[model samples]
Each structure stands twice: as structure tokens, then as C-alpha cells.
Target chain A: MRVLGVDPGLTRCGLGVIDAPAARTLTLIDVSVATSSADADAPDRLLAIADAIDAAILKHRPDAVAVERVFAQHNVRTVMGTGQVSGLVMVAARRAGLPVVLYTPSEVKAAVTGSGRADKAQVAYMVAKLLGLDEPPKPADAADALAIAITHALKGGGRTAASGASATPAQQRWVEAERAARRRN
Target chain B: MRVLGVDPGLTRCGLGVIDAPAARTLTLIDVSVATSSADADAPDRLLAIADAIDAAILKHRPDAVAVERVFAQHNVRTVMGTGQVSGLVMVAARRAGLPVVLYTPSEVKAAVTGSGRADKAQVAYMVAKLLGLDEPPKPADAADALAIAITHALKGGGRTAASGASATPAQQRWVEAERAARRRN
Candidate 1:
């Protein structure tokens, strides 16, 4: 299955596509970031990001979309922008008849680095190693996007075991870590 | 000028269109609410709201779009959904080549009624009186949507005096009241 991962943000949104042939096996297809000028009008900025995501969905035709779940507990100003962009991503995925799944940051980190509290550098390193890339994806957002896609792919597409009832040992650990992180927040 | 106002929400989104023939004179063109079930998926809910807003933009062909500005300081759970819907509305307006303006709840209240602190009932009463309707628009969301449209019309479309540099006496008062409300919050 092919998955498109979106690290949604108004200023710089990351888009990454990967082909998951089997469990714990992945191949990178495409990765890029969409950006808009802060000086532009709010509507124009959002439309620009929407156009980028639409173009990617048309180009890649991924089977499902995975987006970073935004929490209001984050930065007050940036969270709104993140939520807005996530909304656009979900709508675009649904319009294309693709399933949309959201993975928390800790879930992504745990899926890739074996630690829910892994720092960005560790997550990026694992993403590079897992995808067999020469180096980590440029910028943190791009790496995060790929991490989200990897999380969805390894978790059985996030549909069959959303409650972690039928998850593997590794997947169950990730779920437990996510719950702990939420409680800490 | 014809203005389409959007009171954005996840479960229920309000849309109102009005024609401003002259300053302080308005006619109600359309008013309705778009609803989605809470049991539905997140993507489905957002797409339903987006489709309704897109249809209204196509059907009404408004010159400008006005939406209630969402504040993150409000309800944590509801604010995210509000921001998401507002993003969709702004994107639709821009896609149709119409200018989009955002008015805070206080600004809408100040424009429709004399005080920024006016309650929902007062704002609805003023919206009905200004539109020459026998009764206020049904549902508080509908009235709030119309009130946003009326605010844009009364404020000269929100393009010329965005900084309040060239605002009229009434608009200047509204701007001051908005600042006071912000400070109080």
C-alpha cells in the first residue's frame, strides 16, 4: 500500500509519499514541502497550501493519507494554523476517496525510533535508516511527514486496530506510549 | 455589493447572504445552516461543510465573503473545529476571486448593535430590523452569520480602513470597542 503523509502547517507543509510492500519494508516515492508567504492574505495563503496538497494527491494517487494530529495544548498561535492545514489535508484525501488517519507526534516517534520521547534528530536518523536514504530528509517537517507515513504503514493502516486490540507487540507499545504522553500533557 | 457571511462550525455551519443597496440599507438574500452528524468521520464532516460553503459561493455569486474570526482562547475542543471550518470558507472565497474578511464576535455585535457586549438576542434583533425582516433568522448561528455580513457592509467592506486610519465615526467606535474587548480578554 502507498501512503501520503502530511505534516500540516500554514507556513511550511510537508508532503511525503512512500510505498510499503510488506511489514517493516518501505520505499520512498516522493517528498516535498509546500510554503506560503506570511505577508499574503489569509485566504490566499490557505489556498496556496490547498493547491499544493491537491497537486500532490493528483500526482501520487496514494491509497491513504496520514496527517499529524494537532493538539490545542501546543503553541496557541501555531496550533490554529496547524489545525487549519490539517483540515485541508483531510478534506482533500476524502475528496480523492482515500482514507485519512491521524497519528500523534509521540506515536510517530515511537514507531520509528522505539521511544515515544525521542528527539527530532533521533527520529530523523531512524527515518533515514529505515528508508535507506543517503541522509535524513531536509528540514524537520519533511522527516516528520515521512515518520507519520511510516507509523501508519507499520500500524496496519490504522483501520483494523485503532483501539490497539489486535496490534503487534511493537504497535501496542506505541499505543501505550501515546496514552502516557497525553496524560503528561 | 452582495456579501456572504459564514458562521463556521463542525456540527452546524451557518451561511447568510445579503445585498447592500446603500449604506445602512440591506436585504436578506439567503440564510441557512449546514449540518453534519457527530457520528460521521472527521473528514466527512469537514467535507460536508466545505461542500455547503462551495455551493453557496457558486449559487449566490457574492462580491465578498465575511467569516467570524475564530479565537484560540475560546473553548479548546470547539476552537479547533471552528478554525478548520473558517479555513475552508476563506479558501472557497479566494478560489472564487472574492475578497474574504474576518470579523470578531465583538466586532459583529458592535456593528449590528450599538455595543460590542450585546448578547445573541440583541444582535439577532438588530439583524432582523436592519434587513427589514418580520422575524430574526432562525438559529443563533444564522443570525450571527447575517450579523457578520452586515458588519462587513457597514465597515466599508474591510478593505479601505483596515487600520482605522480613514474609518467613519461609527466604524472608529467599533474599532475602539474591539480593542477594548481584546484587552479585557
Candidate 2:
């Protein structure tokens, strides 16, 4: 089973896909962030986001998606960004007919590093080590995404599921939009 | 110009459209909740949600969009719902290229009833009197949506303006999306 770990973010969404099977090694098939201009229209940028998701789905075809379940309701700006990130990922996962699972940060930490209150660095170190990676993942966000994938995979023993995808029609449509940027280029 | 106002939600989404230049009389186009099995597959349901938004757009080619803005960081569940509702709205607005303006609840109340802190009943009363309707709009949510449309028109002074809708890819995608959804539907 192939699992895609996603760090939902506004500027950069770190993605890491692990192919699970005989070799339990979690390989980093891809890593990058999806960005949109702050001054640009939110809708068109959303389409570009959908396009990126479609491209990722086509490239990996992962069976499931793992997202970090948010526990705290931070400030307004942060919440808005998190919402945007979650929205794009939800739209993309649904479009590709993949299941999505969410894990709380603490749950992920405890599962990965044996500490419910493990910090980001500790969790990242454990994630890379547990996944059998040579070096720690570059970005802290990327490592968190990997842990989300690993936690869900551990919960599923490996599979994609979306017991939590409840987006509106508008969300689906915006996701349908392909990248206008790519066409121009 | 016919303006559609949507209060999007997973269990219940309120929709209202008003014909401008006709004394601003609102035609209670449709009011209902879009529901799916809660325990159903998440991705499939999200796809269905997209279908629902398209249906609304095709049914009512709104010239502009007015939606309620998400304010304050509520509980986790409520916050999550706000994200879902906002995402759906952004998608729907982008698909039609219809300029969208968001109004805080207070603004809507103030515009409709001359008081930002007005209650649902007070706003409803104002809507009924302003439209010269026999009765207040049924389904409080629908009335809220209509109020949002009225607020935008009154505030915009009949011009189509929104925060996002520039020459950037994100803006273009949303503007073109309205056309695309129209053509497809």
C-alpha cells in the first residue's frame, strides 16, 4: 500500500509518499510546498492548488491521505491559513477518490516517539529514524507530515480512508479548476 | 442583476437570490439543506457536495456573490465547520467568476436593521418590510443569505467588487470558473 503524508500549509505543503510492502522503508518520493501570491485572487490560486493535487495523485496514486488533526484553535490568521490548507487537501483527496485519515499532533508524537508530549524536534528525529531514513527530514513540517502518514498507516496497518471528508460543492468546483499559471507558462 | 447569497454548510446550507433593479425584491429561489449519510465514504460525499454547488449555480446564474464571513475562533467543531463552509463558498464563487464580498454578521445585521447587534427576528422583520413581502422569509438561514446580498449591493453601490479578482492566476481561475460552470451546466 502506498501512503501519502501531507503537511497542510498555505505557502508550502510538504508531501512525502511511502510505498509500503515487503520493504517497509518509507521512501520520500516527493517533497515541496504549494504557494499562491498573497495579492492574487484566492479562487484562481485554489485552482492551481487543485492542479498540484491532481498532479500529485497522478504521479503517486496513493491509496490514502494522512493529515494532522488540528487540536488548538490558534489566532484568526493562523486558523484561516490552516483552513485553506485543509480545504485544498480535502478537495484533492476527494477528486482522486482516496480516503483521508487525521491524527492529532500529540497522538502522532506518542505513536512515533513514545511521548504524548514530544516536541517537534523529537518527533521529527523519531520520524526519520523510525522510517529508516539516513538523515532527518529537512523541514520540520515535512517530518510532521511523514509522521501523520506513519500514524495513519500504523492505525490502518496500511490503507487510505476518508471517514472525515465533508466539503461543500463549492469546494469541489474550485478543486476542479486546473492551474492557470501552468497553461500560461 | 440577480444576486445569489449562500450560507453554505454540510448538513444545512441556506441559499437566496435577489433580482436587482426591480426594487431589490428577493425571489426565494431555493432554501434547503444538503445532507448525506454521515457515515458514508468521505471522498464520495465531497464529490456529491460539488454536484450540489453546481446545481445551485446552474439554477441561478448570480451576477455577484455575498457570503457571511467567518469570525472569531470558536470551538474545534465549529471552527472546522467554518472552514468547510468558507471553502465551499470560495469554490462556488470562483467557478462563476462572480465577484464575492464577505460581510461579518454584524455588518449584515446593521445593513438590514440599522443595528449591528440585531437578533435574527429583528433582521427578519427588516427584510420583510424592506422587500414589502407578506411574511418574513422562511428558514432563518435563507433570510441571512438574502441579507448578505442586500448588504453587498447597498455597500458596493451596485458595483461588482471583491477583495480577490485580479489578473493573477488565482483570480482568473475563479472568474473563469463561473463561466465554466455556466457553460457546463
Candidate 3:
């Protein structure tokens, strides 16, 4: 299943696309960061990010989108930027008729590194190992985006077997999560 | 000068359009709220807002857009919603090549009510009086939106005389404020 992950930010938004065939095999498809200058006006900067996200969605056409859910309670300025970009990503994915799943940082860490308490370095190492890359992804943001995509592939959501897509551990996890969500609701 | 005002929110985004021929005489062109249901998914709700904003901008063809600048430091969830909608409005306006300005609540109040600490009722009353409306606009959101446009008209920015727009008290105030902002900058 192909999943596009977005680590939303204002100054720099990280995007990573990965193809995870099954439970353990993962292949890196693409990764990049969309940066906006602070000198520019707010509208221009936001439009730049929005356009970049729209272009990525058009180019990748991922089966699903996973965004790191922003907790705006911690920092006001940073959270506003993250929250705005996250909303833009969600809208873009939905416009393409793709399901969007939000994962907390702890969830991504636990899914990738086997522990929610794992440090950033550990998560990055696990991502590199999972993708069978010679070196860890640079700038942490790119790696975090890949980690988020991997988390969704492994423990959150992905394609279904009925939709001409093969089943994997990701589907099973998605089913469980949906059932839990239904129960809580 | 045509002005579009946006009172950004997740549940109900208020939009107001006014034509200030000379700034002091305001004619209400349109006023409405774009609502998103809480029961719907996040992406769908945000898309609804984005589409509504885009439609308003296209239909009104305003020369300027004014949005309430959200301060996310207050309430996390509420601020996130407001900030996201605000960003969407700015992008839509920018896409239409309309200049956008952000005004704080205090600025709006000061511009309309002659006091930064004015209450909502005072602002609403001033909005009605300034627009020559028989009654105060229903739903405080709509009134607040009109106040935002009025603030931009009076204190921040407006179409210049070179654009075939005439002068008024609002333009004089805006010029003074612009000089003050330039000095501070």
C-alpha cells in the first residue's frame, strides 16, 4: 500500500511517500520539504504551502494520507502554523477522495520503534532500518514524515483487499482501530 | 471600495461584504455564515469552509479581504479552528489577487466603538449605526465580521484615491495609522 505522510509546519512542511507491500517490507518512494520564507506575507507563504501540498498529492496519488495530529495547547505560534497546514493537507487529501488518518507522535513512535517513549534518534534509526536505507533520512523532519507513513502502514490504516489491493498487517490494525472507535462513539 | 470580512470559525464562519463608496457611507452587500457540522469528519468540515470561502470571494469580487487574526494562545481547540479558517480565507483572497489584512478584536472594537475595551454589544451597535441598518445584524459572528471590515477600512488599509475611490474620515484615519505603523517598523 502506498501512503503519503505529512509533518505539517509553517516554515517547513515535511512530506514523505512510501510503499509498504506487506508487514515488514517497505520501500521509499519520495521525500521532500516545502519551505516558505518568513519575509513573505502570510497569505503568500500559506498559498505556497498549499500549492506544494496539492502538487504532492497530484504527483503521488497515495492510497491514504497520514498527518501527525497537532497539539496546539503547548505553543501558540507554532501550533497555529502546524494546525493551519494540517487542515490544508486534510482538505487536499479529501478532495482527492483519499481517507486521512491522524496519528499522535506517541502512536507513530510506538508503531515504528516498539515504544512510545523512544527518542527521536531511535525512531529515525528504526525508519532507516525498516526502509533498508544505507543512511538515516536527513533533517529529522523528513524522517519523521516517513516514520508517520510507516506507522499508518503498520498499525493504523491502508488499502483493503476488496479494492483490488492485497491485505496486510496494516488492514488488520485499521479494522481494530475502527471497531474501537465505533465502540467509543 | 469593496471589502470582504471574514470571522473565522470551525463550526460557523461568518462572512460579510460591504461596499464603501467613500468609506463613511457603507452599503451592506451580503452577510451570511458558512456552517460545518460537528458530526462530520474533520477533513469534510474543513473542505466545506474552504469551498465556501472560495465561493464568497468569487461571487463578491472584493478589492480587499479582512480577517480576524486568531490568537491561538487562548483556547487550543477553538483557536485551531479559527486559525485554520482564517488561513483558508487569506489563501482564497490571495488567489483572487485581493489584498488581505488581519485585524485583532481590540482593533476592530477601537475602530468601530472608539474604545479598544468595548464589549460585543457596543461593537454590534456601532456596526449597525455605521451601516445605517434598521436593526442589529443577527448572530454576533456576522456583526463581528462587519466590524473587522470596518476596522480595516478605518485604521489599517483601504483602496486609495488613485483607484478612483474617494476620501472619508475612515481614509484619513487609515493614513494616520499607516504612518504610525511605518514609524514603528
Candidate 4:
């Protein structure tokens, strides 16, 4: 399954594409950040981000799009921007006839680092290790985008059971963590 | 000048169009509310609202678009949706090559009823009187939308000077209130 993940924001939106070749194997297809000027009007900034997302969807042709869900509890200042960008992302995916799945930050962390409360560094390290990259993707947002994609690829839409049988030791841990998170929920 | 004003929301978005003829005289061109089901996904909801605004713009061919500014300070639960829809409105206006303007609720109220803190009823009453309608538009949203359009027509984007000389007694009060509001700002 090929998945496109987005960490939505008005100033800077992170995007990652990955291909799950096998149940336990993953390949990094693309990663980039889309940014807009702070000086621009809100609509223009959103339009720019929308264009970038649409371009990614056209280029990658991912089976599904994964996005970080915006919560009203935190980031009081940027929550609106995050929500607006998330809206644009969902619309772009839907327009392309692809399903969109949203994951919370904690869910992405647990999927990548085996801990819902994992810090940024730990999540970044795990993302780099899982994708077989020499280092974690830069600017944090990129890694986060990949982490969201990884979460969907591993356990999105309640499809976790299919990959359980072929899991390696590390994949087994993620599966266990996901199960725990589900139970907690 | 013809202005399309939007009071954006995810559940029900209010839209009003008006033509400013002979400085102070106003004509109501159109008023309608676009709605989306709460059961639909956020992206789909936004797209539906976007389509409505686009259709209005295409049909009215308004010279400018005006929208209520979404503030993070209020409506914590629905702020995100409001912001997202507002973004969509601005994008549609920009896409149609129409200038977009934003007015605060207080500004709209002040422009219509000569008081920034005026209640909804007062604003609605003044909207009907200004537009020479038999009664105020139904669904407070409709009235608010027209009020916003009236605000733009009366004093938007630092264009308050032109209409000042020919102001009637009521128009004079609105102009004075607007100046006071600007001074306070």
C-alpha cells in the first residue's frame, strides 16, 4: 500500500509518501515540506498549500491519505491555521477519490516509538530506523509526516490483523503497542 | 460597487449580495444560506460551502467580497470550522479576481445601527431599513450577512471618505460611529 501523510499547518505543511511493499517492509518514496509566506492573506496561504497537496496527490497516486488531527485543546494560537490546512488536505484527497484517515499525535508516537507519550527525539529516531534512513528527516515536521504515514500503513482503518503474522521482533512491539493503545481508547 | 458578504460556518453559511448605487442608496441583490449535513465529513462540508460561494460569485459577478473575520478569542468549539470556511470564502473571491475584505462583527453592527455593541435585533432592523425591505431577513444569519455587506458598502478598506459628504442624518451617525471605532482601534 502506498500512503501519503500530511502534518498540516498554514506556515509550513509537512508531507511524506511511503510504499508498504510487504507486511513488514517499507520504502520511503518521497518527503517534502510545503510553506507559505506569513505576509500573505490567509486564503492565499491556504491556496498555496492546497496546490502543493494537490500536486503531491497527482504525483504520488497514494492509495490513502493520512493526516494529523487538530485538537482544540492545544496550540491556541495556531489551531485555526492547522484546522484550515487539514480541511484543505482532506478535500484534496477526496477530490482525488482517495480515503483520508486521521491520527492523533500520540497515536503516531505510539505506532513509531512504542509509547504514546514519546518525545520528539524518540519518535524521530524510530522513524529514521524504520525507514532505513541514515538520519531522521529534518525540521521535525517531515519526520512527523512520515510517522503519521507509518501509523496508517501499520494499523490504519482497523487493518492491523493482516500484518500481525509476518511481523518481525520490532514490528511485533509496534503491534502490541497499537493493541494497547486501542484498549486504552 | 457590488459586494458579496459571507457569514461563514460549516453547518450553515450565510451569503448576501448588494449593490451600492449613488453612494448611500443600497439595493439587495441576493441573500441565501448554504447548509451542509453534520453527518458529512469536514472536507465534504467545506467543499459544499465552497461550491455555494463560488456559484454566488459567478452569478452575481460582484466587484468585491467581504467576510466576517474569524477570531480565536471566541466560539472555541466552532472556531476551527469558521476559520476553515472563511479561508475557503477568501480563496473563492481571490480566484474570481475580486478583492476580498474582512470586517469584524462589531464593525458590521456599528455600520448598520450606529453602535459597535448594538444587539442583533438592532442591526437586523437597520439592515432592512437601509435596504428598504418590508422586513428584516429571516435567520439572523441572513440579516448578519446583509449587515456585513452594508458595512462594506458604507465604509470598507479605508474608503470611508467618499460617502461622508452626502450622508443623511442616520448615515451621519454611522459615519461618526465608524470614525470613533477606528479611533478606538
Identify the leading candidate in terms of DockQ: 3
Q: Candidate 4 on B44-71: residue-level lDDT in tens? A: 6777888899999999999778899887
lDDT of 3 at A139: 78
lDDT tens per residue, model 1, A92-115 = 988898878888889899999999
- Across A1-185, the per-residue lDDT of candidate 2 in tens digits comes to 67787777655666777765533555556655666666555565655655666677789899777776643366566666566556557667876767666666787888888889998888888777877777778787778777877776565433223535333343234333423434667
i-RMS, each model, one decimal:
5.2, 4.0, 7.8, 8.8
For candidate 1, the C-alpha RMSD (Å) to the true structure equals 7.1
lDDT for model 3, please: 0.83
Q: Across residues B33-139, which tens digit of lDDT does each residue of candidate 3 receive? A: 99998777677789899999899898989878889878887776578778888888877887787778777788789999999999999999999999999888879
**Reference contact recovery of candidate 1:** 0.63
Best by lDDT: 1
- Which scores greater on TM-score, model 1 or model 4? 1
Off by over 4 Å in 1: A160-185, B160-185
- Taken over the whole model, the C-alpha lDDT of each candidate is 0.86, 0.65, 0.83, 0.82
At residue A19, candidate 1 shows an lDDT of 93
Writing each residue's lDDT as its tens digit, candidate 3 over A108-142 gives 99999999999999999999999999889987889
Relative to the real complex, the DockQ score for model 2 comes to 0.24
TM-score of each: 0.87, 0.77, 0.87, 0.83
**DockQ score of candidate 4?**
0.28
